[model samples]
Target: EPEVTQTPSHQVTQMGQEVILRCVPISNHLYFYWYRQILGQKVEFLVSFYNNEISEKSEIFDDQFSVERPDGSNFTLKIRSTKLEDSAMYFCASSEWTGELFFGEGSRLTVL
Candidate 1:
């Protein structure tokens, strides 16, 4: 089966550095979402984009965060400044919402 692809499954960054986590969403899906799990916490929604613009964004998505569909095949999340608390599993997901989702294994961000 085809799968979502994410880069740098594990990332280590010092506090305050910029980081870009990348993903390739499944083709034919109409919705894309980014969620994060802060080490042992429940998954939290950061944002959802559809029709090429943000459809919804949680409060957690602030100045430090941004997302884009840089091309027809790629979606990306950029963190302008990293913080220790920012360390977590960042997941990119696509769904019909029709039902569940196909999630990239995830980009694990580690800020030290």
Candidate 2:
């Protein structure tokens, strides 16, 4: 079975530093997305990418964040300047169609 995979399951960085989280979605899926959960908080949508372009984004994806598909197989999210509030579990997901998401084991980011 195909599944999404994320690297560096845990990441720790200092405030003001930069961090990049990587994901590889199911090979044949067409849509990819990044979602996050601040500790004890509800999961929130960050951005969605399809056809190599941003299909949708939430208010949280401000200037500090960017998403890229460096190659067909890998997707990445870069945070230019980390903040204490940036600490959270970031999930990568993909689906053959909207509303049916297949998620990766989250990458936990901690900023100090």
Candidate 3:
């Protein structure tokens, strides 16, 4: 049973600081995505990647954010600058063609 794995399960950073969240999706999955949940809000989609290119992105994924597959198995999301409102639980998910998404435990980002 393979699953998505994320790093830095919990991170505390100052406002305007930079943060990078890492994830490793299931080896056989083709599509990957970065989604976030602000404290008590609904899950929001940030970006999606497939075939080594960005497939789609939400408005919430502004210029401050970037996604990359630096290597074959590692997918990452980098926030150029953190804001107080940026605090949320970022989840990394993957699926074999947009069917069922397997998600990681999520990396919690807390900005002060």
Candidate 4:
């Protein structure tokens, strides 16, 4: 079975710096999403992308965050400025219009 894959399994950055997380979802999947979990917190939805445009986004996806599928296969999330609170395990997921989501091994971001 195919699964989403993320690059830079772990990242360390200073507060105020920028970071980019990259992912490649299942080849035939249509919807892609970004979710994060702060250390011991619940998984929080950030944004969903479909048909090459943003389909839905949570308030957490503020101006500091942005996502793009520069190519048909690779999706990327960029944080314009990192904050201490931004440190978390970011997961990349993809699925069909309706079904279970396949998530990549999360990329852990550490901001100090």
The TM-scores, one per candidate, come to 0.94, 0.98, 0.98, 0.97
What's the lDDT for residue 112 in model 4? 97
Question: Local distance difference test, per candidate?
Answer: 0.92, 0.97, 0.96, 0.96
Model 2 lDDT tens row, 1-112: 8889998799999999999999999999999999999999999999999999999999999999999999899999999999999999999999999989999999999999
Ranking by TM-score: 2, 3, 4, 1
Stretches of candidate 1 off by over 4 Å are: 97-99
**Candidate with the larger TM-score of 1 and 2:** 2
Please identify model 2 stretches exceeding 4 Å from their true place.
none
Model 3: C-alpha RMSD to truth?
0.6
Q: In candidate 4, what are the lDDT values of residues 1-112, reduced to their tens digit? A: 7889998899999999999999999999999999999999999999999999999999999999999999899999999999999999999999986468999999999999
* Model 1 agreement with the true structure over 1-112: per-residue lDDT tens digits: 8788999899999999999999998888878889999998999999998888988999999999999998877889999999999999999998876267889999999999
What is the number of backbone collisions in each predicted candidate, taken in the order shown? 0, 0, 0, 0
Cα shift from native, residue 83, model 3 (Å) = 0.6
Ranking by lDDT: 2, 3, 4, 1
Question: lDDT of candidate 2?
Answer: 0.97
Clashing pairs in 1: none
Better of 1 and 2 by lDDT: 2
Candidate 4 residue 101 Cα shift, in angstroms, is 0.7
**lDDT of each residue in 1-112, candidate 3, tens digit only:** 8889999999999999999999999999999999999999999999999999999999999999999999989999999999999999999999998878999999999999
Query: How well does candidate 1 score on lDDT at residue 54?
Result: 89
